[model samples]
Target: MPDQQRHVAILGAGIAGLSAAYYINEELGPAAHVTLLEAAPQCGGWCQTMPQQGNSWFECGPRSFRAANGLETLRLVHLVGLQHSILLADRRMAMARFVFLQGKLMKMGPVSAIRQIGVWNLLRETFVPRRSHSEDDESVYAFAERRFGTGLATLLSAMLTGIFAGDAKLLSVRAVFPLLTELEDTYGCVLLGALCKMVAQAAKAVAARLTGPRRRSLAVAEQWAKEMKRKSLVISALPAYVLADILQASTLHTGANGMDPQAIMVQCVNTLRAIPFSSVAVVGFGLQAEQCPWPRSQMGFGYLIPPSEGQEILGTLMESCTFPDAQPSNVTRVTCMIGKAEHLQGSEAHLVAVAQKALERHLGLCITTGQSAVGVAVETLWTAVVVQRRCIPQYTTGHTKRVAQLQELLHLNAPQLSLAGQSYSGVGVNDAIRVSRELVQLLKKNWA
Candidate 1:
């Protein structure tokens, strides 16, 4: 590089972009100048936290972090100085998640090691393990039924529907569950696959202990280091298609700047457009603490409605119970996600009414008619966030090939550029952080 100090432009100030900026600055020290740009006024795209009256907080998106094996998430929380702010959901509470099935809520307990190894599920696991296909390949329904049988598939349908708000029958299995494909490829049976995973995890634990924490915790640290090495690098963390469009436009200009811009932009656009995404909405409702049906001691994470139930709302998270600071002592917060993007007509009144009814039916709690008024208390607040269209990239069937193509294109045209976000790898926050760190390292090796 001409100089150790370089200026980098990071597009979109979401968690990925922020992580990029933090890494770039930390790795390069004062030598790197990082500017993070967000089309929106604020950063934290879907990870924003809004203040409620009193000492309460309301998350606009991403309410809780899963603690089971979330090293990257823990690292990020510490890196962002939110360790103290981290609230753990009470695991002991009888927080049974209910999936809406056949017009009634069926108790779906939290996933555990034993539950995952049921004999019936194991028998079917050998021949019908969870597998991913290409975009044009088998659908989620087909893949689920094949691996877990119709019963498990039907059971999972509601949970899947709630999370993605997508139709498993139509959604590409490859795009939805890529890990299952890896499990099948590796072990050929879900049970064996899970066993192998357990063994691998045990091995990793032993290795980590033997090597010490410093060596084991380098994924994010190393990534941050790489981003620090680049000058004038653009971190386009938006959806792939959006990045693609920008890249395509840049390719059209004539001149040294135009050519370089066009070449880089084209590569980005092409890579992003190749991935697919699914849109979803999460609508939250606030009820008076006194009116809550479930006792305070019984509170925990809320319920998820399966697709077979044909309910409008996907699932509800016990926001108040999940996070103590999420609401006031006298207030209760319940978040309902409208999973079916196709069914959303984008009407607040309609969404609110649907959510209210679902809550009444499942939780047996009614939302006072007056509470339906907009701009009410945080406990009574309702919000609907719609991702008009998104790319649902799964690590299934030809995922490796598609990623390989993306990598090859980047290598040929924009060697210094890398893509990171939920669309590329995993959808969870940890996944995003992990991928971002990896990309940072790659950028450092090439540009630094």
Candidate 2:
């Protein structure tokens, strides 16, 4: 019999969706029919970088992609010959991060974190077992507390809170910080695993210098080339409830449609719907440099606000300092975030006001109450707000098991379906593009 026609339907138009569609057409060849579906009229989903008045730019979604783990997005850009369009932040921003702890913006420099969480305690824990039982998955809080005690755990919580914007007590260590868990599992201790890897890598480097590079066979060379050729594309908006309805309909086949139930699609959709999401608000304020409360010397990178500090805002980014083109020299462009922004009801203005109040409470030195009023601390100059409701997925407890089950369900029931998003894997833009590229290659090899 003739081979069944292959048609791939991609839901959403965010970075992952676009990347998948692009790869299906580019890598899989034109034989496959690929339909890119996006509920939003525009593409790029949350990876939007818009222009502020004048020549400056403001990112509505993710501002910067880290240049770690192969820097796939940068390679993708270079491959597309759009190198000039790519942007890089200041070196200081890339190297250092700050956290707002104990009512101060504590610079997370090379030696600074020791002041907050002692290195001696962390060192002592490293010699001990990371977990009594590695089989059971643990929350980020539980996992960190077990390995490094409460002080280190608190700091880790704040750091991760800056990353996921999810409550540390709820996030799964195996899901969110997979590397840390991998270290513990492989070496029976977290630090030992890391140390061994470093030593092994150094030894390998010396051996490679002695033995020289190994030549690859034709097939191996071709495979390596294919993997190296990075690509891009994305999905936009489609509410979870709407997606769930479609999945349910596809599963039951109880409606007017005579089609059989798509069991795989049902399971895949159900698994996706199970992941919890958090709402985040990014409030951008452009102000004169003198009007800012943070000292010029201390502003290498923006500061993250720990939830334990009882602050209303989650974190603040120094857009102007990091991305110089984000604002004019005379103006300082700073953006503050409000995690769980959905819980509060009001307009964007209200969210901005809350963030401003928090900012004043933390950074300002008032004459009377120590809290500067709105428009006084940050000096809001025609602010813009981007509210992402149910944006970042929270990989809560039992997430590792949930993901394993999800993989099995997709592989067996819905072989044609693929999931790539902040919900399943890493939330960065690099992850979206890299995962899609790898998945497309796999699909191509298995297309027969």
Candidate 3:
């Protein structure tokens, strides 16, 4: 630890890496020299926004975020001065969701969703006995099936397919939905834990109303100032496999820490490589508003197809319904997501046709394959197909344990290096920003 400035090399320029760089600069100011390195020519990674003519745009990646859990994302948005461009989905529009079960689209309102999962089965979850203590991690589906029965587990699997584009049978409940696991661990029942949390949150809200808002004192700043010593730092926000490749090719130093750096690297690299990923193809379609056959009653956030349906596409998002300003008033936008890494072998046109066929089957739309409004009622304004290979990290069973091991190895062998991004803890814009801020604060506190 010295008074001199330190160099902070941040790998990747994705949302997580960008957030890390921004936070470090804001926290350390002139005390650290931040360098952002990206393998791609452009930043933002999977958060790609493609522009179309007529002042419209297509979100080839994640279209909208859950506002309730996106406090960090909102803070970042305000910091970057894009607050004015923000659009909120209508409350009703956001709630109306559908699932392509059987042959037709079934609207999943609160009651219908519960009925689909069986209300008796859900009620029985609280009475279900908790499992005995075990070190091994379980799949999301297994955890659900154990507590809530097969109905709930099946629904969870379908829901997870939409979120992670991954098989819920393979996804780790501890890594993917830690809150669910934590609830079960703490209360022996997820429902009981949720009810307790709600009551506690309500109590806190009432207390806050009477006491007014809490004030931040200068003690935090004083502590940070005292710990603001200089130290070299390398924050990696790259994919786990990519980072493993980089580390495997690089040299390391064993210091006086007495840990075997070579052994640590080998284990770390193996763990990183073991973290699997899922690819997806996002097919965006823009159609004339007048020509669109989707009814107003059916208008809402688009539908998700469960694996039981044996469909080629994962789901579709009604972009125009969610974000009205994203397209012109005359244009209706929708995006189809095709999951599975192996399904992305054909050309972009072939992918577009596949998406179109799915839409035709589910939505009963008259559309041609890879053609724009040729003898079709739905006048196609434009179409875009983006195939993202190995994009979403699949936190499979034992993912949490593997990550813990990787962190321990890095802490012992390479104290200067740290990992962040969707590959590690959480996977979302909000999670990225939140972890980046947290990592920066931790680095500031332990800079020496």
Candidate 4:
């Protein structure tokens, strides 16, 4: 590694690439020159934000990211001097989550959600010792069901809906929720592991006080181990505490896939392809104030429809309510999403009509009920359909090992090149930023 000017060409001008470029420009100063390339002409990747004549803003991709993911991206946002653009969802709606069950949308408040999913089930997960796979990985459903009950395991499907647009049964617990896997692996039980780890940390701190500098290195090693054991998905929108064990499990390991090296690498890639990616169809609608109605249960950011309920659209975001400044005072922008990739293959007009019908059905709105507004014309609907084909990555079973193998292969075959984005690591905005940060650091070592 040299401390001189270097030209870095980054593929995919998404958030990850852009974040890398930004960090290099600011951190490395003129020592690094970044050329970000994307197959598409535009940047921002799936975090697209479109604004029109009024204050109304429409997003074909993600509207907002979870604040808990990390401060890296938020710091980047401020570094670029875009802090004023930030918008927070209404407090009442922010924590509210909903799922379709028992023939209607049920608010997943603590009482109802605990009753529906059973708190004892989670307790079982916390207390019970679950089996581990030394060679293979487990699906999200299987992993959760073994520790937690089937109810909470299946409920994880709703959370995955907003992410992979795929099924939780198919998602890899080790990949998507690696923190849980590591916890289970370390102590045989996640909760017990956490309790022991905390106790051990306290004991180590006391030892450091007695041993001084000699024990400092041991403490540092232990701290690194603790960090290695905890990697979050960065964009955790749900209650992160509930998913306390789910964290990053990225580490270099071999022989986990199988004994055969070449066959395992091939199988690893095949597994990557085998992991299904769902196409999301988003309808961004600009509605008059009278069109959008705020329901009591729909007070939160938005609601997610579980696969059990079986609906065309995944969920609806109360855009106006969530980001009040994104819309005009006289208008409320509603965002409706259909996780099915092929749904938007139909005519745009047909898609708009279908979305309107869905909004009416799910949210109980009169906007499109005949949409039946007195003087509002049907043409004023101003609906736009965004079909994102395979934008999200599905972390199927064995994903962590597969990713580790892929990294190994890259190191062996293409040492100079690296992969970064939602596909390789976590699929949140902050995840991308963190990946980019790591990438820049690596490049500094390689090209500085």
TM-score per prediction, in order, is 0.78, 0.82, 0.89, 0.79
Query: Tens digits of per-residue lDDT for model 1 on 212-322?
Result: 311222333334444334336666677776777777665433423345655645555665676666655556655554434554433566666656666777777777765
Alpha carbon RMSD to native, model 4: 9.0
What stretches of model 2 exceed 4 Å from their correct place?
1-5, 201-243, 252-270, 289-293, 341-343, 365-379
Question: Which of 1 and 3 is the better model by TM-score?
Answer: 3
lDDT of 3 by residue, 120-163 (tens): 88888999877778745789888988888776676777778788
lDDT of 2 by residue, 29-135 (tens): 75566678877879988878767764565678887766665478888878778889766788876565777777777778657766566787668766776566745
Against the true structure, candidate 4 has what lDDT?
0.63
lDDT of each: 0.60, 0.65, 0.77, 0.63
Model 3 stretches astray by more than 4 angstroms: 1-3, 200-230, 255-259, 369-376
Ranking by TM-score: 3, 2, 4, 1
lDDT of 4 by residue, 1-448 (tens): 2444555666667787788778777776787556666667788787787774455667888667766765787888888999888876676666676776655677787788678668787577667766746646878887777887777775787878877788888888867876676667767887676677568776863443334421222222222222221121121121111112221122223444345544444544454465455678888877665434656546567777777777878877877776665566668677778876456678777777777777767766655543432333322436667787767777777666655665555344324345566765677788778767765554444343
lDDT of 1 at 64: 62
